[model samples]
Target: MIKSTDIIRCCASPHGIFWLTVAVLAIPNVALCFTERMGIMASVTNIVLPVAAVWLLMALGRRPGKTALLLFPLMFLAAFQIVLLYLFGHSIIAVDMFLNLVTTNVGEAMELLDNLLPAIVIVVVIYVPVIVLAVVSLRRGDVLSRSFLLRQRRRSLAALVAGAACMAGSYLAGRDYSARLHLYPLNVFYNIYLAADRYKATADYPQTSAGFSFNAVPTHAASGREVYVLVIGETARACSFGLYGYGRNTTPMLQRTGGLTVFSDAITQSNTTHKSVPMLLSAASAEDYGRIYREKGIITAFREAGFHTTFISNQRPNHSFIDIFGKEADDWKFIKEETERSDMYDEDMLRMVNDILDKKRAKELIVLHTYGSHFNYRERYRRSEAVFRPDNASEAKVSNRRQLLNAYDNSIRSTDRFLSLLIRQLDRSGAVSAMLYTSDHGENIFDDGRRLFLHASPIPSYYELHVPLLIWMSPSYRQMYAAEAAAVGSNSRKSVATSASVFHTMLSLAGISTPLRADSLSVASSSYKPGERHYLNDHNLPVAIKKILRGDEDFVMFRKMNLKY
Candidate 1:
């Protein structure tokens, strides 16, 4: 029973056109939920945010030109979602994804675009018409009359109230659900802000001598020629390793290698390399990550303990957190110039290792950061080295699931070769030496039907955090420190462990006594206890590691020892 005059006025006005554009763009937003196959309640709840956004835009876009421009942000966000959905088969804009697009170099960005060309085409097809429609609507001379403005001002206030009420209701229902609401531009904005703030915090963080002292060193400093090698791997998951009970023999070399102890329960503190590497290299934990980097990192401690510290990386040297620690080392070498390189394999770092070891420093600690099993898994190894054949040939599409798994397993096998060669080098050195190996973070390969394909989701998954930790020492080193070897062997099967323990354990491995060191956190000590491990996302949201691993939301346990976070 609508009047013809009223319908004509609505069609001719800029306010009406802007709302129409918003409504069209909103389909992609709500479509995200349906595509993910979320429950009816969750899908219905998600509409509340977009509806509020529509009204808020209507309030702000009173002017014709302003309305068109404002609509661009939402439309662009929707376009971005379309591209991601086509590429990853999902639309969860995460902190790592934001930084990779905005902060990474042009080449890396190009590589990413090149990999997802098919998805890009789909995005263009879906969004180009909408963009045209918006521009045409904006170019119109239509305006809001005095009467219309008065009415909209009132609607604007109501929309604001409704938005707030919707957010509150979502939060009251569940904190986790509230965080998961993927409202297009708002969610995108939150992730970008978090990435920028996090990077700034790391760069501008202050370091003081307040809690740092050199006099805390204990009397167990190495007497003879000793070498401590730490190999920091990239994107390796414990479940993929044969030693950790995987069906595939991904880590055949490690399984057959002697004098290697595998800690089955190890997990990383963060899922991204930027955050995880800092936590592993520095005495940082989930509770005090902001201020922990202010203290001197492990490299500084080793240098102070009269050991020649060296850092060699196969990955590019663009990471601020890693670069800061590397700068502190006596010798820092970067073998790879590009951030993402397909021609250079992880074995490239071995040349640097051999060169450094040739120097024969009496007491030294060398850290090798390798490009191990990063995405585009097929490119990580050479064409000749692709042992697992018929893997995914196109990055844009997973035409075959078994092929993708084969490619991933092949990359893992390449890592096994790299580690085995590294151990052989240490063995040949014949110096009292020990090597510690672990990945910065793990990768996600759509294990569940949920279609989660990568790390950095706000949601926590067990495979993304559970990483492999291996400790290998030469015969001479084991004989020299039998007690330490025994302790490591005894604690390999402990139910809980985290990268936070790396700082304390590295200090113990170097036999350097320091007040900052805690024996309870060290795996090579009788008093060692695998205490409660807490996992955190880029937004600083906490998830109980134990609860998630057990697939139980409500499980409680007590800690036998107190360890500072």
Candidate 2:
């Protein structure tokens, strides 16, 4: 048997260090084979091309130390890839994922990282040593032997030729394969470029949309008193709500509440909050997301229609379109900015709503953006709301799924209570009123064999896209608009895209007439029609759900729920 000392010496050698660096760099590429869906040729080329490129660089450089150091940037990419793989299970680094790094606040980041200890540990163990080795090798002036370098260079050239051939073969065989799209570092770099481009566009939004208008007008008499509230929930999955046939009584209050219509088959166009929320608030859909940069949101439409629009949000501003659109309201306040407290709950937003209602404007439109059922789920609700016991999961691990789910269910219960109370307040207002509630997107809670556990993955799972959409109309409003109320109930089981439907439906419910509104997309309209669903991809392009959804499991789930994919 070889001694431990012998193994150490071999590892300490320049060749060993060079190979180690290549292997470490190849981790993400190798991982893509298992995590991503690709055919045999595409998978083989993905691994071979990237590895060959690394080998070529090392051999061509002659000095293994400097070459490894030159490739050090990839170490960071590898760490990011591994962590994402641990969290999402598939797909390359997306533009939104990159943007989220900048937009995610310290509190939110810590909450996510707190549960990602295992993945973080794995990243640290795999990368830290290789990084140290690269530094040490560089300082020691380590060089590859001339003979070894020549051999490696020849092998790398052959591998590159084979890889190129396989890539071409994959395309010829009708598979979609490209090095920049399928390969690791190349795809990651392209996404970085995309993220930067999007950031620049976001910075320029004010100027781009400065002169845009909804040209809105009221269909009802301007003298009539109206109160409409749009509640945008965060990370609330329909599968966890009692109103949507969940096993638990998470939404007991909502279930019992009269005149409430639950859109059981609602799905979001985008999974990330920044994209999804903007879509919900604006006329922008997966088919026309680019229009967001050149148009104002639904708040502006309401304001133009002679309603006193107010935006009250429990979430902290992330300097995205959400902030821009919220600020467009006649009156707006971000609760977190005023409170400066981490434990601020959704109920705080209710107080703001009460304050606005007290003003008793002739026509009012209030948007409540609640911090609903986000991670650290237990904190979303009060202790009294924790009807589901043993919900104190310290870490976000699959092993602690029961506790995590319990906490999530409790938060949903709290939401149920919050909505019920809001409805009661509306009933008491004695104005022609309606409330529309839907989430920006749903959450994944280690739900299945895939083990996905969050929103905003590059590719969304069934849970992440499926959300709960509810509408509550006051008795007076329902009696006044009987046809609209009946239409809402009729469309309850329809395949609805909240991003498109919410904007049109809200206007319909409020009796607003805007040229931008489409009757077919409005759930409240008698002309409502359920169309083919689409997803807003990373590049801001609309892709049919059937074309984008990959896994058989996701298709099965969509079919099982009778939802169009």
Candidate 3:
């Protein structure tokens, strides 16, 4: 028979109590994960929550047992599910936020549940054990009685402090490295979480001076011109396009067209479209956006200038930051292809654009925002019929990754085909149609070894910033604005531009004037300089771009960031 003390030691071990504490403490950390971006399940979330729970209970003198250990798996599973909710919660919340806005929860849970399986599996695998232990601990309450545990564990106080430090330190490090650029110190964890957004928005503030802010362009010209079309692309970083020196034939038609002004060195001020689009049209840098006056965004400027401005986007109107641009557009239409609801190609948007062009009967500015090259690549593209498979499987037996990429490229090709038609239509209309095409950002395009596609920080390399910007002025408009054409084509040093200059450039093209317009950005203005480009990351930090512009020998060899605007 086993000795009585040996049996007692087994019953009094701390593992059981520790696991139970974790299950309880996990509730809050899982909740915070949802506030970031949609669709993520970081492994870091797995360890921290439970450890904190154990730390809290052990700090008060609790000894664990077989029952508590048994509870571990079950709680672990539940915690996993909660992390899934945290990651894709925004997408799921689409139904919830929408339902609550309209008061309908009929399909809320089910819809979120469908996309949640991957995250769910990951969570259940991690948490199931802890959950089982929590239940077992509650049932065998007598053996693990609270008062007896407190008295027995009184001498373990030093170990408790050490364990708590480990737990707290892990959470702090994970929060900083995993989310905030690995930038903040440990003590600043709470402060970092609290002030993340304020920092991103603060970028626009530094650009503002005294009485000025972002550019304020009137929608209509004093001359009362016709229509202007702004085609805003998605995830189309310039680093990949052949026109910008990539080996691919991404923009042949754009290159063939003589009137298109390709900005070889244009940089986006923000990493994600959510931040970039607002900064672009809002007429401010990420640093100086809202110093004093809340200047209107692109469409807002057009509206204020007396034009009926509208926005047609393939991106979900409610997808996180789409609202940043969507809210300012006088008319907003979000076309999500995944719904299988709309019967339109990119060109079909032309019908709507044409309708507005006719209905307005005066000058107009139209913005067509695309959902091009977004991941879930297969869904974005047409069925691939191309013979060249990257992985050498020309047949249909290819992996999901290969097929997904092929599908994505096909989608880009389809967009190109649509653009060709759009340009032809604009040319045939007999009215001046000035078209400017630029993506909010670019895609990864399988450049990095990372399996999944991502646009924001951590993986934000040059591929995300170098985007194709093709501006084409209709023949009549070109004739009228020949000096602008010469300025754009000139090899002079002053033509350089950051995405911030796009607002001023468009305003100048449309004969609209804005206070923030620099001479280089305005064809109407004679003042110009060369060799200046400012690029910003998701955080709106200038360090990366500044290095490239300072004639860093590495960038100089590649002729990278020094492009004329």
lDDT of each residue in 1-565, candidate 1, tens digit only? 9998887467445765656565667767676776654444445556655666565566564565456556676667677777666544555677766665544556555666777777677767655655554566557655667677667657766765765666566566654554434455566788878879777766664444346654435345446688899888888888788887788878888888999998877878787777777677877776567645467678888888888999887766665677777777998877666445548888988877898789888888999888787777777787787777797563645455566677888989999999999999999987888988899887767564444455655444566777889999899878988988898899887744456788878888778888778888888777897777877655665556654442221121112111122
Per-model lDDT:
0.71, 0.88, 0.52
Per-candidate TM equals 0.84, 0.96, 0.67
- In order of listing, the candidates' clash counts read 1, 1, 54
lDDT of 1 at 425: 92
Candidate achieving higher lDDT, 1 or 3: 1
Please give, for residues 1-565, the per-residue lDDT of candidate 2 as tens digits.
9998887567657897788888889999999999888899888988988899888888887667678778878888889999998988898889999999888778888988998999999999987876777678778888888999999999999998998888888788776677778877888899899999999999999899988888999988766579999999999998888887788888878878897888879999999999999999999999988898889999999999888999999888888999999999998998888865778988877777887788889999999999999998988988877899899984757998999999999999988999999998888888899999999999988988888888888788888888999999999888888989999999987889999899999999998998899999999988998988899998888988888876787888887777876
**Scored by Cα lDDT, where does model 2 land?**
0.88
The candidate that achieves the highest TM-score relative to the unseen native structure: 2
Worst 10 residues of 3 by lDDT: 90-99
Question: What is candidate 3's local distance difference test score?
Answer: 0.52
Candidate 3 lDDT over residue span 1-565, tens digit each = 8998875454334454453455454553445444333123232333343343344444453435444454454344345335434442311121112212222123423443443455666665545544454455555552445765565355345444554455455456544333222211121233334334443443343243233333444633345356788787766666656566755565566556656667665656555555666565656664464421345466765665566677787655433334555556777776553457533346557777667766745667778877666544334444453322452222111234465455555556656665666777677767676887777776544443332234444223455666667777788877877776666666223343445666766777676655655665543334445444555532335444544332233244235555432
lDDT score, candidate 2, position 544: 88
How high is the lDDT of residue 65 in model 1? 43
**Higher-scoring candidate on TM-score, 1 or 3:** 1
